[model samples]
Target chain A: MTAPDPRLSINQATIKYAPLAEALHLTAGAGITSIGLWRDSVEAASLPEAARLLAGSGLRFSSLCRGGFFTVPEGPARRVAMDDNRRAIEETAQLAAAGAPGSAAVLVMVAGGIPQGSRDLVGARSMVEDALAELAPEAQAAGVRLALEPLHPMYASDRAVISTLGQALDLAAPFAPAVVGVVVDTFHVWWDPELTKQIARAGQEDRIASYQVCDWQTPLPADVLLARHYPGDGVIDFAAITADVQEAGYRGDIEVEIFNQEIWDTPPGTAIARTIEGFGSAVSPHLLQAGARR
Target chain B: MTAPDPRLSINQATIKYAPLAEALHLTAGAGITSIGLWRDSVEAASLPEAARLLAGSGLRFSSLCRGGFFTVPEGPARRVAMDDNRRAIEETAQLAAAGAPGSAAVLVMVAGGIPQGSRDLVGARSMVEDALAELAPEAQAAGVRLALEPLHPMYASDRAVISTLGQALDLAAPFAPAVVGVVVDTFHVWWDPELTKQIARAGQEDRIASYQVCDWQTPLPADVLLARHYPGDGVIDFAAITADVQEAGYRGDIEVEIFNQEIWDTPPGTAIARTIEGFGSAVSPHLLQAGARR
Candidate 1:
């Protein structure tokens, strides 16, 4: 098979069961030069050790899996969520610092769902704005870009309330693009009618922190959270969306972030191998490659 | 229980097993004065007999369940869909003529998803636009309003490419509001950040052809199509959306079009009664009821 796309990053969730060490070794061994990590795995291996492993693997740290979930009403719970985000911000900074050259100090943010037992969707969304205003400075100080990821509308109620790239961009507007950016994930926003316009807007604003690739298919599995598929395996037009992101001027690592149970169950090496093949066939051609060239 | 909400319409899909005679009987028997119907049930009863039964029941026809599904690329298949929609338009005009005063000659349109095995979403969406342009004049000539219904984004790939009120309104813009309009269903659009703005826009354009209400709950069913619930059974803020629709000048029959399997299994009478209770408790208090008062 062709070598992994120079810009391809295997998001840790694609090999969910693989711990930090194995995930790192597998991604790097597969000749993938970059990886995005989940906080749990990093914390499992402990930040310093995870950083040591990442540095030794010679992989660029694309981003931390997540940091934002502070949709709670003002209370101790809210405080706890804020503290966790601060810790995540610190983790992202240290990890990015320890990675090979070309690493990005970015932390993906999934705005939390509506508060429990409450139908106050507007209130819940406002809470995300409040959290961003509170966390933006801290993230900036840590030299990290808080990447607001607008999840698919299917996950709006239970997972992430941010359901459109436009909404994410509006939230990120108050901060610098390098401080608060947006993630364009194919699986989440591929069906959007405003996708082309919004990708251009994100590019013009220079807030395209991460461009994730995956596919969406019908007969979504029992747990919709695991409904993601590798590039080219499902219906997402990666070429179209990648072209949009490329035109928008996002010259960054393109991460394959599938959450399918089948992919997670596959041997890590095999999973990474499939990712490489999928990316080479479905996504790499559309990329501008200036980032890789640099 | 308190009297059924005066403006509430029991959409026939809420009682899927009920035949036309039975559905009309259950709806009118429960003192529910209005209903929206599915073409399958209407066809099953035969149009003349169905009209006779509806006239005998002395109930108003809120709208027809659906008409549009012509997202297929230009072909014989697309021609069949357009012809079918024309028949649906004729049926809407006839049913409205047969119903009690205030019956609306509205045929709801669900723009079909991406054509089978075709990843051209934009092209598929254009098919919906083309279908509308072809049918709008015919519908107007028949005194029928084609209400473009934007299904939840989850169904964008396989059910309807029109997945937002804003997009539906955009598609409906080129036609006169009386000929082509939009359906504002709370379940499909409650998560949209621009819901209030779009509802106002639809109202201002005189294009609010139908106002449908249903709750959205998490842990969607195995068959996500049947994931709808009674208004009070989930996290949807009915008061908020109902008030928005009310303020937008949509003082028409509010339909509760549920698709839950358990609700479908319930006796039609019980289902109607439950819908009455749900609408009264969750939706009625917020409605201005000027239409009912008139």
Candidate 2:
């Protein structure tokens, strides 16, 4: 039998309960060739050790989990966020250097939510644009692309002001596609009505940075932030969306990033196995269709 | 002392704890000229008696709370929803007849959530369009317009598939403005980046059916559906949104409709008072600004 698609990636956060090195080892052991790493876990294992582990595992880094929260209002706070982001970009460059050729070298950017005590959403978004303009040079210099991720509209208040793929692409329009791009995560964007047009637009603009997949479940856990489910467990049309993204010319890792507690509680190896099983059913056909579309 | 700006209305669902008669009495006593009625309370008191109560109290019906759940796929279920909407239109006509001239006589339509066991959001939205086409003539004959309300995207999966003001306006495009229009509720739309443009579009199209206001709160309650807060209690930019809506030429009632446990737990009188105070602080200035812009 053919091995599980090498391009199928498991974002470490999907099994966040697993320690970074263990998640990486388990992903490689499961024959998956790619994994998206989170900075928190990378920082927790010391970057040098994390680098050593990745080099040994042969797992490609399909984009770093994140590095953008530029919504703070105070000058000092703003500087601190930028400083952290710059460091994140440097780390992303290092991860990319360690990965095999053609692996995703993108650094995902989740624009932070509204500033404290501020009702100015437009103002807050402007801050993100200003922040991105400031960071573009640093990202380009570091050889890391900034992938602006548009979280679901539900998170517009406290998680991200960027709530739609079109808005994200628009924000990225000012920068070079290599310096700035957008992340299309099904969990956050599946409900968007303008998704089809936006995905195509992202393709035409050559700004599709990372394509993440996870299903959206409702009654969204009390801490809705962590409520994402495995694909096929919820109502998303994975086949259509994957096909659309592929049609958009995103020839990159299909990263599964489920954030549910139950999945995290499972044994790491079991979780990865289940993730692969879900991915095979939910995404494979779309990849073939996307090839046909081209 | 200026009598709650005659156009500032109260949707009965905002103070759902109050009985139909008592809520009306309180609204009229408060000097608020309009109140949007809900079917449950109207039915509880009997529609005819409700009509008498409205006529006697000198309060106008800004709009009936709602009537549309066309997302149900079953043949019997679809017929039931259509029949219910027809009755709702009839009720809207009766309420309009009871109110003083110039009062709102629109039926608010919340396109229902996705059907049980179906992940077809596009199909569900199409069902709403078909339902609206069938109901438009009925609404026209009754002299009560159908106001399609685009609920927040968070409600897309379960409460309303129509998740944008633009989509709502698009659905209402085929019908006459007097037969079908769009409702802009702040709680559901404040996060939309396309809001200002959509509000202007709705106005240009003469599709502004009702303008409702409620603030969006976070760490949303376990029952996220009822997590909305009173104006000024959350993160929405009421001034900008209200100003934009007013700028769009919607010379209609600004109905306050919050769904929250804490607000409901408060005494109805206190809740109404708080809502009015919140509205004055959060929304009134925008109305004045809109007038100034004109």
Candidate 3:
């Protein structure tokens, strides 16, 4: 059997407690080949310095954390949001230009939620489509594939109106390959019934921008803002989902993006080590050993 | 516009704090047209006494609480579990037979969860199918239309492996309409991406057995056993969901099924009254308006 690819990518949020340079160095030292950095982290350390650190560490950019909150409702505020997204696209392009070769890495898109005082989720979804249409040309020029992340339904009201992998696909369908795609986060969509079908659809459409892993806790807390489950801590069927993604022909970085207070409080290195271990124990066994191969 | 139907149905668990006969009397006095009694409640009250209370109160039977634990793995224990489900089906038949003409109701089925020490969710699902096949014929003879309740995926481990309406439909698809159908409960499936599609499918397939309502909390607790949101308390796009159900031709009692510690602590009368109010403000506006226009 061929050796398993050791391209473990660390999401900046996993070590959000650490400074960007420190986190990058930590990830590199751990021998992880790739890293997914947030724009905020890049902003905190000057982009040039952050780029220098990546260059020194020899870490390939898996993806730029995000660049799409285009679901703002029509009005002055919407224009402002669009302007902000354009700036984000420019920054993503700059990062892409500075990073390793190939098509510019994915610019993860998180469709923003319903505007204040609006109950129209469908309307918000349309707003995202319109914004993506507006931003498509610029994104294409930058050579960055926009990865639309469908947040969990719990965040549908205030985070991302695009709340399903299928819904994200519908939004991205109208755009060209480089202009629009999707980010599949396990934390958000581990419970979806059409998960396998949607992932297959994503692969067929060539819209597999990123694949993330996390768990879904039961007895979810009353507050939605703080609700998130660590990768192996909750009850998501990760093994089956990963297998489906692979079957769909997606050979991208299986990014581990966890949003947990408990994990976040720990030291960045410790968290990364724990996450790496969790990924191996929870996912690798299933992905690596299928049928009677074991 | 037509007046909305007000046939209140008391799920035995609603007044679990009270004795079964007392609950029946209280619900009857509240002018409810129907009542749902759990097997445990009936057993605790003595089946004959429970039967007498139902007869005396002139309450209609909306449904027998449940009958399905086929996911228990193969063994002596599995046989015992199946036997228990069969007995539950027999009791439901007895309840239906004892009811007045046009008053007999369906038997709600909570498909069992993954068997102990088993991680094979799909295998557990097959067990449910086998159990349903065995029980369907008996249920048909008893005049009980088995209403398979698709529980939340969070309960896939220990409560019910049938976690989506679509999955439930697939399970019920092979059975005769009278032998098997579906109960769409908002609490369990509010987060489903294909909810509208599945509800439409259920309607098209003529498999809708009951319509139930509840809300989903955000920070889902870590514990699986004690997490539920009351109607109108959480951020589910309920109006849109029920509208789809209505368009799909599901016309039934929009039962209020809340499993919350706060609500449970309140007096049954207060809880029922609150449920009625919440149901009206949160759900009825959408459902009743649709009914009115019809």
Can you rank all candidates by DockQ, best first? 1, 2, 3
lDDT of 3 by residue, B175-210 (tens): 987779999888777656578899999989988878
Selected candidate, larger DockQ, 1 vs 2: 1
Q: Lowest summed-lDDT stretch of 10 residues in model 1 chain A? A: A285-294
Clashing residue pairs found in predicted model 3: A219-B220, A219-B221, A220-B219, A220-B220, A220-B221, A221-B219, A221-B220, A221-B221
For A133-226, candidate 3 gives per-residue lDDT tens digits of 8889888887778889988765666778787898889888888865788888877766565788989889899888888876665455555444
User: The CA-based lDDT of model 1 is what?
Assistant: 0.91
DockQ, all models: 0.77, 0.71, 0.25
Instruction: List, residue by residue over A1-294, the lDDT tens digit for candidate 2.
Output: 235665689999988888887888888888999989999999999888887888888888898978888998859999999999988998898888887666666899989999889999999999899999999998999888999999999899998999999999889999999999999999898888888889999999999999899887777788787889887888888877887888889888889988878888889888888888888877775686424546
Q: Candidate 1: where is the Cα deviation over 4 Å? A: A291-294, B291-294
- All candidates in order of TM-score, best leading: 1, 2, 3
Give the range of the ten consecutive residues with the poorest summed lDDT in model 3 chain B.
B1-10
Instruction: Give TM-scores for every candidate, taking all chains together and pairing residue i with residue i.
Output: 0.98, 0.97, 0.88
Q: Is the docking of candidate 2 incorrect, acceptable, medium or high quality?
A: medium
lDDT of 1 by residue, A1-294 (tens): 789988999999999999999999989988999999999999999999999999999999999989988889999999999999999999999999988999999999999898889999999999999999999999988899999999999888888999999999999999999899999999999989999999999999999999999989998998899899879888788889988898888887989998888888888888888999999999988887574531
Report how far residue B214 has shifted in candidate 1, in Å.
0.5
Off by over 4 Å in 2: A1-3, A289-293, B1-3, B289-293
lDDT of 1 at A44: 91
